[model samples]
Target: MRDKAKGDGTVKPKVYIAEPVPTFVENYLSEHCDYEKWEQNEKVPRDVLLEKIQDKDGLLNFGSAINEELLEAAPNLKVVSNISVGYDNFDLQAMAKHNVIGTNTPYVLDDTVADLVFALMLSAGRRVCELDSYVKNGEWNAEIGKEHFGLDVHHSTIGIIGMGRIGEAVAKRAKFGFDMDVLYYNRRRKEEAEQKFDATYCDLQTLLKQSDFIVLLTPLTDETYHLIGEKEFSFMKETAIFINASRGKTVDEEALIDALTEKKIFAAGIDTFTQEPIQKDNPLLSLQNVVTLPHIGSATLKTRQQMAMTAAENLVAALQGKTPPNIVRG
Candidate 1:
């Protein structure tokens, strides 16, 4: 597809937006490109995106897979701008084969996602959601007893798997906000994090067995797929509360369900799942000791807008033959 010519005979990049963005983002895109957008509340259908992208130079979307099929459909495609930080949706091998650049919004949502992870941890540890329902459903006709008791967050030991930017934020909260002890396991040790948060670097097995709370924040990759499974779960203390604010596929869903069902762990707080908009029949939904959310770790209004803007800037920069700041390399 050829670039659209401006009235002054200059060519403007043609872009397609597969998801709705704030009016401000649209205005920004308008200043740099000739673009078309999906205006509906729901995500643009895959078929429609393939069709619309045929003549586009760049695409801005949330988590669409950028594989050979999509690349072949858009021969002129120069870049794919993902609104979220995780680029697992991108098939880097295929993108590189086609000489396409991929970018994601990072750093912008670290604090917001960290806030949700802590929210999940507190909700699960304190049984806030379960107890709230207990009172509203008239199940708490009298003062609650030991059976309704929940764990405490402050002063507990927290194990963070896959320490990164968000993990550092969580560590800061644990250390100062709650006076909790922090332990972390990552591909590489972060000395800065250890010094800043008084965090102890340890092996995965050690972290799992010793911490009162376990949080998974690893990015999903071939190596990290199902990083935590049955054996890993068995290592945790029976009183441990597990939280997953990262991609769902990083943990084996069936192993998690088994651990929860058999009381291997006290409870869990999950923001992402193996399957999104989780099926009603998923056993996790039926567990009283679990707190679930709809993958909204970075869903705050202000943060989301910033992410969109970052993605837009990346797309515009790549289309203009400049190096985008947040490129995802294979």
Candidate 2:
């Protein structure tokens, strides 16, 4: 499709949206530029994206790999606006080499995701889902015993890895709502967090050993991929409850399976995973001590709409030769 010329004789850029966006975003795009959107529930096929992007000036992408090959295919592409906080799906170096600016929606879903993290922690720690299954399975004839009792959340020590925005939000809840002792390990000590939550800065080993709950909130990177493996699990208390709301590659999934099977940790609440749409045969599904979700950390309706709008604004800004608010600078 050709760029639509406005009454001012300026050509509006052609944008390709890789996934369906909210109606408001669609309206904005239609009014600002000539655009084509993928309306399927599933991801746009790699072939389809490559073909459609051949003449696009910008791409509104989500969960699609943007690399040298894709960039080379879209010779006129100048910007890629991702509808997610993490751009691990993108190759930053390649984008830079191709002179393609990248943007992501950040901070919009922080509180919503933090809320889900806590929900996972509480559900797993209390065996809420397991007991719900038991009751529904007609196995609640007898009164529950101490053997089936759940762990306590209040007054417990929680160690958080990667004390970023979402992590800090989790800390606030842990400190204010549950009276938890929050210990955090980050690249550097955050004095503000210390003052606000009375959080203690601790080494990973110490945190693992002392904490009743361990929450992984780190981003996935070369230094952090498989950061939590066998050795790290060994450092945890046998009664420790592990929670992973971070990237899947950050944890060694097999090692985690072993830890659970060997009873190294009490239980785990996992959102992200090594593979998305985790296979039905995945062992975690069969384990009673595990609570797994389909990576719905930021799935709230309002948050999703906000993210789509933010992403649309970023794409529009970049296409209009203005700096987007959330540009991913290397």
Candidate 3:
């Protein structure tokens, strides 16, 4: 029986990429494990997933939701490798209950995400997108109005929520590159933030009240869901700016639209939304003060490839019963 158990430990571990992983990522995974994909484009069918994942030794998943019900089906599953940095789509407590180790690729796209954050900040504050539209529609010389002038980002106060890796990176951009005072609110104090960015760690209320630009970088969790609603917006300066490169559900969409309509805030740059692909009739999209993106915070080719390779490497390591470099949830 001891010999059989040893053999079981050494047996070839099957690795599954729930979605079609990139070729380089596949090659990287192959360097360490026996791997195959489940789907080419869209998600593999639910029945197909339920049937195929039953005996998987390890799984690398994407946007697909993995809950307790799915975990129950995979008796041999030992690990989950998430392609994205955010793992809210995966049931962490349920995975822990099943003795399943889950890993996410964080920090790999830190700079890339920070770059996009600043890009949105500049575009929104300077009205870059709207100005470009004006030129495209032959209205370039018609912008001599009181409200057409853009806000000054330099010498402004930048408020950040969620002082995580991405949040810290955004601070560097605002404080260093744009010459802004960095104010942040986290669940706890970030001492290193003061040393690095000269950030003023304050209560959520203080940050909202003081900042000229509010940047959201928090992750999606129960505590953060709808974290920025009307009460928070009421405190923002009328000339203030807001940008969300974080999860969509973090902000109250209705409140944000109302803020834009009433001119409570000067402008906004939003990437993620309450619903992705933002329905055609979404009120926020109709607002002139808001600039929206298709949730491409880490969409640069170089960064995405690196994230995929990192996820693949972590999955391979977890499949072989080794400690993955970026394992989350303790």
Which candidate's lDDT is highest? 1
* Cα lDDT listed for each candidate: 0.94, 0.93, 0.85
| 1 or 2, greater by lDDT | 1
Clashes of 3: 0
Selected candidate, larger lDDT, 1 vs 3: 1
* Model 3, TM vs. native: 0.91
* Residue 2 displacement in candidate 1 (angstroms): 11
lDDT of 3: 0.85
lDDT of 3 by residue, 12-58 (tens): 67777887767888877765666657856766777777777887778
Per-residue error for 187 in candidate 1, Å, reads 0.6
Candidate 2 regions with alpha-carbon error over 4 angstroms: none
Mark the regions of model 1 whose C-alpha exceeds 4 Å error after superposition: 1-4
Please identify which of the two predictions, 1 or 3, would achieve the higher TM-score against the true structure: 1
| Ranked by TM-score, top first | 2, 1, 3
What's the residue-level lDDT of 297 in candidate 3? 88
Over 128-237, each residue of candidate 2 has an lDDT whose tens digit, in order, gives 99999999999998999987788999999999999999999999999999999999999999999999999999999999999999999998889999989999999999
Q: Give the per-residue lDDT of model 1 (tens digit) for 1-330.
A: 456787888999899998889999999998899999999977678899999999889999898778999999999999999999999889999999999999999999999999998999999999999999998998977888999899999999999998899999999999999999999999999999999999999999999999999999999998989999999999999999999999999999999999999999999999999987799999999999899999999999999999999999999999989999999989
Q: Could you tell me which 10 consecutive residues in candidate 1 have the lowest summed lDDT?
A: 1-10
